[model samples]
Target: MEATLSLTDKSGVADVRRRAIHMAQALGLSEKLQADAALIVTEAATNIIKYAGQGEITLKSFLEGASQGLEIIALDRGPGITNLASARTDGYSTGGSLGAGLGTIARHSALFDIYSVPGNGTALLARIADSRDGALNGFQIGAKSTPKPGQAVCGDAWGVRQIGTHLWIALLDGLGHGPLAAEAANRAVSIFLLAELSDKPADVLRRVHQGIKTTRGAVMAVALFDTDKRMMSFAGVGNIVGIVSSGSETEHLISTDGTVGYNMRTVRPSDVAWSKGSVFIATTDGLSTRWNLNRHPGLTDRHPSLIANVLYRDFARDADDATIIVVKAT
Candidate 1:
């Protein structure tokens, strides 16, 4: 459900454009939407080659209710946009070409967001859902799930479920890499989404643990967010990292050192105060734990998807499957 392509020269543009169109067709998007995907990736690839000299494009497909969406993340370490505001305008261009790129990209996208720093890099996010009406209102989510460089299947998985006014977010890293681990992660999510009764993080996790015993097992974390009470209850096991951040303040979520399904330990959910405009990030061990948002100016305010992309681009260890979920409080 994901593909990452490296763009270093103009010759690679056609490959990316074709990939986008094929993916759009595969996702059952309309012909117009398929054309839109072609235009977006074409413009994005051209910009990367002209401005940054080299960059990467990540294509991910997602399901929103009955509709499907294709997301594109364009990342570059070029001489960052000195005036992102002007760059986004319809008639402005610094690369001596037509300036209609950003405006056209945004116009055709169901969701669009970008972040840039003068000396740092730039991250752009655009999602074209088959239909926007199926989206649930209230908050935002951006996630990146990728397998190891040489592996065909990723061993990490994540999901979000709505329960009344609360939201349950789950992240899991299977025991190891490749097919067996992917099976474990997939099996855990099936149990997470099908359980009959409780909405509690601990209870839901218990169900998953029991259902996944036949697989290799996984390192997992679950959080339940109550929007009305502004509280989040977190329960986890192993090294799955959970973080809540706002401005310069941050808190690390606590988890016991045990693998789910294979070993048993206390599963206690801890409540933390959640505030408006704060962000919660959950990650597998594939990403380095040393990331700090304070270092990336204006990143906290962009769309959750862009934030997730920037973090993944900068902090990925690249040796194992990586999955990161960035959920923002409204």
Candidate 2:
């Protein structure tokens, strides 16, 4: 399950803690683990409210082989930390409170990473798993989505499934904005999750098109990667964009015109080579088509979540549901 909460005031801290505890219980965590998660969230939320004034927190479930855990991502646009190393030190207070927050969070988490710039704000990611052996089995998947202004839900959605050496990723954008559009996009995501992992990208989209015929229709992109073969197969319809960076050069995956479930034409899968350092990205039309990697040098070397967040922050349009997904071949 995935949940998001806004932290704008002191009360947000309690809400985050409650949500964290609820998530831990839902995941069958022990009482001690649940309490620890709540405390960590409380500390993170308190810092956001005290210093940043406003921020957002995302809680999502993660599975790695037989182990499962909860991942927390907190994002803010306040005055950023000038020295990350100093900020992580114990007793180094910047907001008049005890400065043990970041260090404590790192101690409780199986994986922890924080990124900040003096003017670009900050993002923190923490994951706590039940497995104490410290082994995780999965590839990285990161994305960001925000609803259009004044809308209650975003009309863009994404999904992923991995089986053995094969991985499938999908991005859907409904015909327009608002609830009806969200309905179409969410339906596509549901179908993506239910479809067989071994299905080809072209066949998968064809099935999704048929499954969501009653909805308003959506523009969809699907990418299937075979790690064992070091190759990728991609198929897309409508305006959704796909980009694959092969270290030496970037290749653009083209999508045919027409909306899925509405007026899609003949669909064909494009094959591309993928390896350990290759990067894959897909985005909805809510982003400007002019997004350039040259402008943000070294971004490809960062974590996928940070890369997605940075793209969303810089390229997202204001008038529509914005979404972007980033995945790196490993």
Error of 2 at 109 (Å): 1.0
TM-score per prediction, in order, is 0.93, 0.82
Model 2: which ten-residue window has the lowest total lDDT? 132-141
- Residues 132-165, candidate 2, lDDT per residue (tens digit)? 4423133566788888978888999988887778
**Candidate 2 pairs with clashing backbones:** none
On TM-score, the leading prediction is 1
Candidate 2 lDDT (Cα, 0 to 1): 0.82
The true-versus-predicted C-alpha distance at residue 260 of model 2, in Å, is: 1.5
lDDT of 1 by residue, 176-261 (tens): 99999999998898888776646678887888888899998999998888888899899998899888887667888988888888
What local distance difference test score does each model get?
0.84, 0.82
Report the Cα RMSD per candidate: 2.0, 3.3
